[model samples]
Target chain A: AQTVTQSQPEMSVQEAETVTLSCTYDTSENNYYLFWYKQPPSRQMILVIRQEAYKQQNATENRFSVNFQKAAKSFSLKISDSQLGDTAMYFCAFNVGSSNTGKLIFGQGTTLQVKP
Target chain B: GAGVSQSPSNKVTEKGKDVELRCDPISGHTALYWYRQSLGQGLEFLIYFQGNSAPDKSGLPSDRFSAERTGGSVSTLTIQRTQQEDSAVYLCASSLRGLYSYNEQFFGPGTRLTVL
Candidate 1:
């Protein structure tokens, strides 16, 4: 069994500033995929970025990036130049590569507020 | 549509009533997944379907929750004798293949189910 944890319940960042949301996971498998998803007030879940466990380099998607530490079992999402539109709930997810099935285990989530 | 599509944007049903939610995966996608999201919460994996394979029902909360995919394309999640606890948003997603496929999943708008 695998599980994802988001320690931060709520986070706030000034517009144009940077914010980091922490995430950790428990998994027995050596290979897996990590993902960050965003949910806005409209209730649509959107993929922010994704990181492959085998890749030592972090994944970056425009303003969204991830610091993936395989040994520490940590995958944190960093949002740079945060804007009001970035205010939403962020979730960390994990999927075991061995399964060959796209079932993701998600964290409780972190609520981000971008202040103007 | 280019992305996953889900029907019945909103559904309100009395307790004990049955509710059905539908999901249409993107064409050529070999994997589809169902997840539940409570208000202000994270996604809970419910069931996963792969082309012509037995679906993974492990994430389903209870026997009352069931889902099936027809022709490996469109899927339906059925809740029998719905309980108030089932009140939440049901989401659908699809990827090119399973966990190891390296394809990113696209999410649907989701069906908001209110079991009153």
Candidate 2:
């Protein structure tokens, strides 16, 4: 069985500053995918960024990026130039090895507050 | 393009009553998944449907929970004799294909279920 852990339960960042949300997982598979999803007050789940385990380079999507360390089993999300709109609950998730059904296992989540 | 949509956005039912939540996946998506989100918790995988294959009910918490996808489009999750513990937001996501295909999923706004 695989599991994801988000050690930080709450985080706050000043507007225009940067913030990093930590995530770790346990899996023996060599190839997999990591994802960060955001849920706002409106309760909509939005895809933030994704990283492929095989790729040594980190994944960046505009202001959202991920530092994916395969060996350490760590995949952290970094938000640059944070804005008030970035205040939400962020989740780290991924599919287990070779599961064709696309079921995702998610972390406990980090409540990020981007202060103005 | 329309994303995944769920119906009965906010449903409140007394405990012991039956409730049915609906999810309409994006057109052309072959894979759909259902997840539960409790207060201050991560998303919990509940069920998944892929094309005509047998649905994955492994993540379902109990026998009282059941779900079905009709004609590979709309899905319905039903809770019979619901308990207060069943109160949570039910979310639906859809992807171009199954997990093995490595397609990113789009999520719905989710239906908030309140079992009073």
Candidate 3:
């Protein structure tokens, strides 16, 4: 079984600043994918960034980046130059690469508040 | 191109009534998934469909929960005798391919179901 955990239930950041949301997972599979998703109050889930366990380099998408430590089983999301629009519930997810089902296991989520 | 779309963005139903939620995936997507998000919780995988393969119902919580995808483009999740515990946002996602492809799953604005 795989499980994802977001230790921070809530986090706040000032506009133009940066915020980091922590995530950790437990999986015995060596080949897998990690993802960060954002869900706003409107209840729309949007993909933020993704990382492959086989790749040593982390993934970065514009202002959003991830620090993926495969050995430590850690995959943290960093939002740089945060804006009010960045305020939302962020989730960390894991998917086994070999599984044909393509189902995702998600973390508890971190509610982010980007203050103006 | 339009992203995934779900109908009846918000649904309020009686505790004992049955509710049906719908999802329309992207035109060329070959994989679709259903997930549940309860208050202050992460998204829980419910079921998955890929092309014409057998749907994975392993994540379904109970027998009351069931889903079906028709014509490989649209899906319907039916909840029988809904309970308060079933009150949550149901999310749908679709991807270009499944399994080792590592395709990103695009999500739709979830249907928020409230059982009273």
Candidate 4:
């Protein structure tokens, strides 16, 4: 079984600053996918960024990027130029690559607050 | 459909009562999944349907919880004799089939179940 872990229960960042949320996972699967999702008070899970385990380069989506260390089994999300809108619960998720099933496991979310 | 959608955005039921939650996957998606998000915990995998076959159901917490997909589209998760511990947000997601595809699961606005 694969499990994801988020060490920080909550994080805060000043407006226009950067914040990094830590996540680690235990999985034997060689090939998999890592994802970061944001859930606003509206309770909608929004995709932030994703990284493929096979890719050596990290994934970057404008303001959101990930530091994926496959050997260490670590995948972290970095949010730059944080704005008030970035305040939400952030979750780190994982999934088996190309498996017949669509099972995405998530970590205990980190509530992020962007203070102005 | 525009996106994955779950019915009855919020459900409040008494203990020992039966509750049914519905999910409508996006049109053309061949894979659907169900997950439970506890108050402060991560999202737990429940079950999934891939073109009508669910090869893996090991994630289901108990036999009292069952889910089924019909016509490879809509799905329903039923909890017989719900317990207070069953209070959580039920999330549904849909994705395209095949191992080579991007395999990103689009989530729906979860149904919040509060067992009293």
Report the backbone clash tally of model 1.
2
lDDT of 3 by residue, A4-66 (tens): 999999999999999999999999999999999998988888889999999999899999999
Find the 10 residues in a row with the least total lDDT in model 4 chain B: B97-106
- For candidate 4 chain A, which ten residues in a row score worst on lDDT? A96-105
Summed backbone clashes in each candidate are: 2, 0, 0, 0
Whole-model lDDT, candidate 3? 0.94
TM-score of chain A of each: 0.97, 0.97, 0.99, 0.98
- For every prediction, compared with the true complex, DockQ reads 0.70, 0.72, 0.76, 0.59
- Output the TM-score of candidate 4: 0.95
lDDT string for model 4 (B3-113, tens) is 889999999999999999999998998888888999999889888788856436777899999998888889999999999999999998888873433577888999999
What level of docking quality does candidate 3 show? medium
Tell me the tens digit of each residue's lDDT in model 2 across A14-104.
9999999999999988878889999999889998998878889999999989989899999999999999999999999987547678778
Predicted candidate 4 versus true structure: per-residue lDDT over A5-111, tens digit per residue: 99999999999999999999999989888999999988888889988899999999999999999999999999999999999999999887766574788999999
lDDT of 3 by residue, B19-110 (tens): 99999999999899999999989999999999999998998999999999999999999999999999999999999987654799999999
True contacts kept of each: 0.69, 0.69, 0.71, 0.55
What's the lDDT for candidate 4? Answer: 0.89
The DockQ value obtained for model 4 is 0.59
Clashing pairs in 3: none
For model 1, how does the per-residue alpha-carbon lDDT over A33-85 read when each residue is reduced to its tens digit?
89999989777788899888999999999988888888899999999999999
* lDDT of candidate 1 at residue A37, scale 0 to 100: 90
DockQ for model 3 equals: 0.76
